[model samples]
Target: MSAAYVEHRPISSSKDTLTDHHVVIVNGASVGGEFSTQLAAKNYACKEGYHPVHVARERHLQNRDIPDHWRKDPC
Candidate 1:
């Protein structure tokens, strides 16, 4: 061990199954993020959907006064 100690984390929802699958979701809403997070916790890959209209609505508060150039991807 050096000056800094390292730690290891066991992945959650370890699985022996190899039946790959995809989950199609609605726009990137809170529920969408939650679903993806849970599936990843269970060892599944995820694909999230995003619509410009939905994103604009969702990020209205965060982008209230910030200039477009300085903001990060609204997704």
Candidate 2:
């Protein structure tokens, strides 16, 4: 089974618009899974086991943030 893991870290000492970074982990690994929002990171990690399906659907919905390589087609 896979699970979502989140790590919080300050981006810098200065007061910035985006102060923190959220890294999403699953099965002790992270691959391009970083988000400005914790909810997005958690949602990314939660789809670990079903990445292809999620990517496909998200792509269909015109979610441009999703990487092209992660899509289900052309496999």
Candidate 3:
């Protein structure tokens, strides 16, 4: 007689499904740097099987003092 293996799956709700996604903040002294960092993080998350969402707050751009050199795009 051969034994059959069965895989078990969990029943999850909408809120549980939301847990599969993650939120990350993309912020830096410059726009390019912030964008690059966010992309890197997203790529890493995807590789690990998690959905990454880039999130930013208006306060991050408000009253923020970034130096002239850092404000320039590295590209």
TM-score, each model? 0.18, 0.42, 0.25
Superposed Cα RMSD, model 3: 19.4
Worst 10 residues of 3 by lDDT: 1-10
Residue 25, model 1: lDDT of: 25
Candidate 1 lDDT over 1-75, as tens digits, reads 101111112212344433232221232212322322223422211123222111111121222234441222223
What Cα-based lDDT does every candidate model obtain? 0.23, 0.43, 0.26
Runs in model 2 with CA error above 4 Å?
10-19, 50-75
Of the two candidates 2 and 3, the one with more favorable lDDT, higher being better, is 2
Question: Could you tell me the C-alpha RMSD of candidate 1 in Å?
Answer: 17.2
Off by over 4 Å in 1: 1-12, 27-49, 52-75
TM-score of 3: 0.25
Task: Please provide, for model 3 over 34-73, each residue's C-alpha lDDT reduced to its tens digit, 9 standing for 90 to 100.
Answer: 2234335344434444332222221112222333212221
Clashing pairs in 1: none
**TM-score: which is higher, 2 or 3?**
2
Write the number of the candidate with greater lDDT, choosing between 1 and 3.
3
Span of 10 residues, lowest total lDDT, candidate 2 = 52-61
